[model samples]
Target: MIWTLFLALFFLETESSLTQSAAIVPQDPTLTIGSSIRVTCSVKPELNLKAENLYWTLNGRRVPSKFYTVLNSTALNLTLNNLNGSKQQSGDNLLCHSTDGRILAGTCLYVGLPPGKPVDIICWSRNTKDLTCKWTPGSEGETFLRTKYTLKYKLRWYGRDKECQEDHTADPYSCYIPKDLALFTPYEIWVEVSNRLGTASSDIITLDILDVVTTDPPSDVHLSRVGELEDQLIVRWSSPPALKDFLFQAKYQIRYRVEDSTEWKVVDDVGNQTSCRLAGLKPGTVYFVQVRCNPVGIYGSKKAGIWSDWSNPTAASTPRSVSERIAGVCDPKSGEQNSTFRRELKQFFGWVKKHAYGCSGLSIKLYDQWRVWLQKSHKTRNQVLQGDKS
Candidate 1:
């Protein structure tokens, strides 16, 4: 009786293996959405099942016999109509079964839409060091899958196409190109996207490396009063980190606004220096001042690089309005030793000019020009006073 039971179990197991051996057609196919596709199930000739004995199931639901046809006793075929992205992306599973409802064989169907072309690709470089580009996903942004994006770039005249390394920026659609970039040679850039369905590429954009140069903002900004002059504020800042090697000349701009006002008054003649004296500010009023830099003549090119971001605002108030304190110190009240008084006043102004650059006095250059003009004015003033007495 035990031998009989063992043989019976063996026979059942063999029968189950045979039932599951039917070959499902197309074996995990990938196809486009809205397109029609065929699937088939077949078995060995000796084990061929009659059409009435065979059936199919999709995602655990019975497939209607009306959608299938029997080609022979050994083969049955099913046709899917208007395949959708959901079916493709999820890899819908199909199974062949006996009429009694046991699974014979199975296959997963892949149906999804290909990624659409990327759009609006644009790029910029930071202080001529690295290039960064970003784009918008194309084709309704629905690939029904986790699509991958890549940035590809190359020089117009040299080098092979290269892929940018993602430094893990917050923007997934952006890519950074680092190191050994050409400043004069134009670069072509684009984005490529791909997934199981298909791949698409964005339009190519070309740009000069210098044209997109932006750098870290000027740092260590400071503001202070200019001597006793209540209408002047001196602004100073250091160069950006990327430009600190003294490899290029940088032009600077200074702008200021009153604490209670939004209007900014920009100084256009700060030139390439790192310091500027701002005059004509309202005495005793708080002013907000900022500085920006643009590198010029780097790499021996005449083009001026793009401006860096504005430095953080530095606040300072012009000194309260005061009468001329130096007038008493440098002036001879009764014109005694008039020649000696003139020399003393000149000496006093010279000392003030030396410290003026760091303070609110006119810039050193302006101070020199000022002293020359003052000498002419002082000589004329004394002559006129002496003539009036006579």
Candidate 2:
């Protein structure tokens, strides 16, 4: 009976040891890139084991022999030196196993890249209230290569003895010029781009702020069917009344597009002349037209000045045949009446210009008046044509 009891006791002790071996647990699972982490394998009863046989593997691949060391027989620690927080190395499973073959534990690690670059840096003069520096998106990093950018800016005022003022940072590259910059003076601006590897600089851009002056819109905008076969349209208008003779150097920009289309084609090179022609238009199609001015000085040595607000949109349709329309209206007896009508029309325009506060309603009223005149003129010409036919 004693022998039977001994066998049962030995069997119970074996089962307890097995249960304890299975209870070994691993350390925490998360680790950041470029950081160190310690992993431990714990068992219930510490086994006085040697360090040489402790093994570590990441994702089933053995870590290099020199990268880590085994602590006591029951504990193993790893120091991932200079860890590059790359996605490929992040969240990978790391396993530590002992030669006793009974203790094993694993942990998962995570790595992350740096932050994105800053945006929308605007430079304005404190003195002139003019925007001196404006920039769009700069260069970024490659997908295979983790990358970021830094921005820097420099501002220099003419005739000032001080050196250029600059603002920037290695990370989140952006700068803004305050509103207190001197007004009515010229300033030069520059921007730079940088990354973890190197940097690039932009060419200097210069701008001038003029003393604020009262300005008015352009006047006498007229559109007429000009070309014969191709059915082109010609637009003409006088310069803004507020423009002094010295500002006559201003160049005009004409923008036009078909009424049915949303795209706006620009003629940036319209010279000092007040007229511009748009060709290659579809015959019998209605078109909308507008104009703006860019005041350039010094024969392009300086950048063009700020653009004026766009003129009121005027519309004109190409006639199918100019000769037929003119013949219907030509009458020697009606010449006196036509002259009187032209005089009245000029007076009406003058009154509108004087009283109109440049409001949208005023523009609509002008367009409506022109439309009424056109309808009346067409009816009169039709009556003359009918009389000639009879």
Candidate 3:
């Protein structure tokens, strides 16, 4: 019984394959957009089907009967005009169905335009190591078909063309070369995009690995309050450590924003300085600061390196104004006490600027310093009065 069941399955599979092979004529024809074609469906004499009994459907929707033509008793023709591009990348399915709505035969129609030329090719290296390149697709970039993108490069003066193994996790139009990049020699890079329609190439861009190099963001970014300056903060950062061995002069940029604001104020005049003084800020407010670096003239090459990513944000707050504190804390009715308090407060902050560490100019030591200054100021005032009387 088992043997008989296996034989029955084999016969069914064979009949299915034969039925598909003998049905659709010009099976799976790829035509260009706006083109027209006449596809024929022929039924086997044994199926006892008539030409008028067969209907057509495309992508599971019924085709209009007006487009059908009766060729013979066992054959029918479908005339499609002014075809558009396939709705899917896998091409559109056209099927011939029997009177019972059973699918008899099927084919795929490929309709699309050739890819346009790739443009705006750019390449850069990270730490003079593996290179990466990206390009913009030409025209609409949508061919409505399966398309392939390849990044090709070679040493400009020597060596053969090699395909850049694409990193799938990267952007769809970008590729990465992890290692084995030449430093001094110029390299030519371009991209080629292709599909069933046609292929296109981008303009070749030639660059040296050393010239197009970038580095990691500036490290060890520290932001602090400027000494006794209510409206300024000082931002300092270390250079990108990886590029120190290379011959390059790196420039820096600093940007900062208040704690409650998303708008950033950028300082562009920092030049090559590792430290910059940000002025004209709201006092008593915390600010977030970040820095980035650009290496210029690397390896004596004239081309400027790409800017590194901005460093992680570092936070610090400008010192509160002495008047602001006095307005909130001092007793308004006591004129003498208020005067004496303001004087001691000024002296305390001045001393904090000179000697305080890690207190943001408002240390617990401030009260002790205020007491000492009060005692000294009274003695000095008395001595001056005695001198005046004498």
Best model per lDDT: 3
305-377: candidate 2 lDDT, tens digit per residue: 5566788989998754333454554443688768865875786577567655485665544644543455466
lDDT of 3 by residue, 1-390 (tens): 999999888867544653652388787788778999999999887778888988999988999999999999988999999999998878799999888887888889998888888899888788898898888888867787777889999999877999998655758788999988888889989999998888999889988898888889999999997665667788988888988766347778888999999998888778888898787677688999999888888788788668888999999998765556545644346887688668767877676666665675564346545544544565577689889999
**How do the predictions measure up, each by TM-score?**
0.52, 0.40, 0.78
RMSD of each: 14.1, 15.7, 8.8
Q: Give me the candidate number with maximum TM-score.
A: 3
lDDT of 2: 0.56
Model 1, clash count? 2
In the range 139-184, model 1's lDDT, one tens digit per residue, is 6676666578988888877869988887346987888877878878
Task: Tell me the lDDT of model 2 at 110.
Answer: 47
What does the lDDT read for residue 388 in candidate 2? 100
C-alpha RMSD (angstroms) for model 2: 15.7
Clashes of each: 2, 9, 0
Return whichever of 1 and 3 wins on lDDT: 3
Off by over 4 Å in 3: 1-22, 329-390
